[model samples]
Target: MEKIAIIGSGNVAWHLCKGLQNEHIEISGVYSKTFANSQAFAREFGLEVYQDLEMLNKAEVDLVLVAVNDDQTARLIEQIAAHHKVAYTSGSVNLKDIDHPQVGVFYPLQSFTKGKKVNLFEVPFFIEAKNMELGEQLFDLAWKLSRKVEYADSNTRSELHLAAVFANNFTNHMYSLSKELLENSKGKFEHLLPLIFNAVDKLKNSAPEDIQTGPARRNDEQIIAQHLDKLEGDKKEIYKIISSSIQKKYHEKL
Candidate 1:
């Protein structure tokens, strides 16, 4: 097991540390700008905590995982470049932005929350590196943490991130809006839980196009109009746009 240091103590850092710890990897220490966060994470993982970047210079670690926010990733990489091999957990950042030759991406394509246990071994990891040798090393590190690992170039990773935003983030936004609408109607939002689960369940074995069912799919202008009439304010406009887009997609299929 290789010794590892993590540069951030946020959700990604927490989950990564937990996964690595479970695999009996050597977590040398964790660093955070705030002592509180670093202490908390270190206590959880039973590793040392470094509060200062300079202190990390003395820590014995093979690789540093920069799990900071996307904007801070590049700067953090630069700070750690002189000390150890570094990798970031960002889905959108390109490795070229960092100066380290051993720099790579160890992006886990899942939303992480502290205290909420996620099975990291089941999550997909997208790895990228500056060279093949570094890429293989990063892949091995990722394989230690996950069973599903893929080597994707920056461009492909960027596209995957965009698709993920649509599939996960935007869809979650839609769910929030639906819940809000249901609450406004004096109905329990939980009523939609089964439908949401079933919709996702269908995707396991069915293509979205083949499983899609809506007024737009049937070209039922009457039902569409009724739905639009039920919606109010900006929601009505959103419904119109989404219905039109869905109709267009299904029409193209026809």
Candidate 2:
């Protein structure tokens, strides 16, 4: 059984620990800067908590997984000695830029939220390692948790992360705006659920451009004006910008 130690107590660390616990891996310990968070995580997972990471440094573990913020990743990586095989779970951060021999990326390309259960097998793992052997090992480990595991270099990973922000973060923000728009109005956000689902289902079998149907895409200036009149401030600006972009995009094909 492979032993591993985690270096964080956030959402990623919790999910990583929980997922690995079901496998043949043994979680040796967990360390965090905050004692309350670290203690709480250790208690939940039945693992030892490390206040000073030197104890975990000396411990015999096959790998040390760092699931900290991008800002904290370099600090933690520098603290971990060369003797340990270290892997970080950051999507945008480049592993090549970091000065380390036994370091790699174990990025999972999916949004993680506290209390929300994520299907690990459905989530894709984008992996990159410092060397061939380490890459292979990281890939193997990722494959254990996710059926969809692929090799991605730092640059590719960063680009993918940027795309993910557009696809997930920006899209979710649009949903939030929709929900806000619905508040104190004639309908609730629930009214859009079926429409949203249909749009998503259509995307499975059709390209977005092919199925693009909206006042913006069709250049329906009347409806567009009505929508713009309903919106205010940043929302109105966002609508105009997107509508203009959509009209321009469709016009280019003609």
| Candidate 1 ranges beyond 4 A from true positions | 252-254
Give the whole-model CA lDDT for all candidates, comma-separated.
0.86, 0.90
Model 1, global lDDT: 0.86
lDDT of 2 by residue, 26-110 (tens): 9989999999999999999999988778988888899999999988898789889898999999988888678777999999988
Off by over 4 Å in 2: none
Q: Model 1 — which ten-residue stretch has the worst lDDT?
A: 76-85
Distance from true location, Cα of 60 in model 2, Å: 1.6
For each of the candidates, give the backbone clash count: 0, 0
RMSD of each: 1.8, 1.3
lDDT of 1 by residue, 106-207 (tens): 899998988898988899999887767767888998899889999988878888888999999989989988987887576788988999999999999999
Best by TM-score: 2
